[model samples]
Target: MPLPYSEKVMEHFRQPRNVGRIEDADAKSIEGSPACGDMVAVYLKVDRESLRIDDIKFESYGCASNIATGSIITELAKGKTLEEAKHITWKQASEALGGLPPIKTHCSILAVDGLRAAIENYEERHGLIREHKPTTIEVIRKRLKRVMNPMVGLDLVRTKVVKDIEIADGVVRVAIDLPADHQFAANIREEISEKIQPLWDVQKIVVEFTE
Candidate 1:
């Protein structure tokens, strides 16, 4: 209730536009994690001849920042060329919403990631173009970077609270080091868990917290 949110963010959340899916979406992608308690799905309808995004929609699962980011991302992407839309970074998305709170930065990342993922999914599924995909660890870091602390305005990994990440046989192990008075340990663990759940190779996730 006391979270810092820009007016643009509140406006979008209060009246999120393009909240559904496109039946014949040219590109569709789901990103983020339920364990982290934020997830986003993007759908794009492109013009066949021009390769411009004619329409776009999204499905968001999370808090106000999540829904607002998803809404703003779609609005920004619509009517742009696929390449242009794919290049829309999370920072731009956040800026379009008049800048998101530090804690909500990751929400913008998830929104932009969802859109780019949809584009990549479209290209791969259609045999249009092939690109270098992120390794599992890179993917994990990207997700973790968005799991920012509300109080600190930095991600757990960047703040060194999340010390290490390990993966073996589709199971992920996370190591967390927090000050004893840290108020968000449980929530942080849940966020990290949710972020990795969508990874194809990730079957299970275990979080360990330390002093």
Candidate 2:
């Protein structure tokens, strides 16, 4: 049987609306990692006078959950003022989809983070905010260097299994590779979540595995 998915997830995944690009977009932002298996790019046409997102489009390369999330986020942000759109959180995206499987929670984060990054860029260029933004994944290793696999007793970084990590929109996602039948998969996720949750903006942590 296929993995169980909520009706909303299937709806968005099967027929993702706003599935392309916005040309000469007033603001654009992209997040996720190609090497680790997902990337999301968002483009927006903003009404400068009203500071509202007039139009939005996205291109995504990832699993079904990621695609669904990209679709839902656009639907949520479209026509909303920039301030309102900027406040769109991962929780709202997942809630709209009736919640995701724990493993798929990261996809929602990817969706919202992409939106925030684009808006942040737009704001910076418009002189709404003035702070340097790192164009790459920021400090993944330093934060979770101590997260260990209970069975192997090897920290994630030292084990070299952390293919990619992304943290934003109050969510943390770490993708790793392990044996398909690894017994402690859930344990790994729980332990890592425990260690990182307190320190980061992480309201949720997704420990995804590639077998």
Q: What CA root-mean-square deviation does each model show from the true structure?
A: 5.5, 10.5
lDDT of each: 0.79, 0.76
Best by lDDT: 1
lDDT of 1 by residue, 95-194 (tens): 8888877856666677887888788777766666755453376677777776755456556777877678887888888777875456777777777776
List candidate 2 segments past 4 Å from native.
1-3, 130-211
> Model 1: which residue pairs collide?
33-194, 35-194, 36-191, 36-194
CA shift at 89, candidate 1, in angstroms? 1.4
Q: Candidate 2 lDDT, tens digit per residue, 54-164? A: 999999998888899999999999999989999998889999988888877665676777888788778866877645343224555654554554444445677787888
Model 2 residue 15 CA deviation in Å: 0.6
Give stretches of model 1 more than 4 Å off. Answer: 1-3, 130-211
Please give the lDDT score at residue 41 for candidate 1: 91
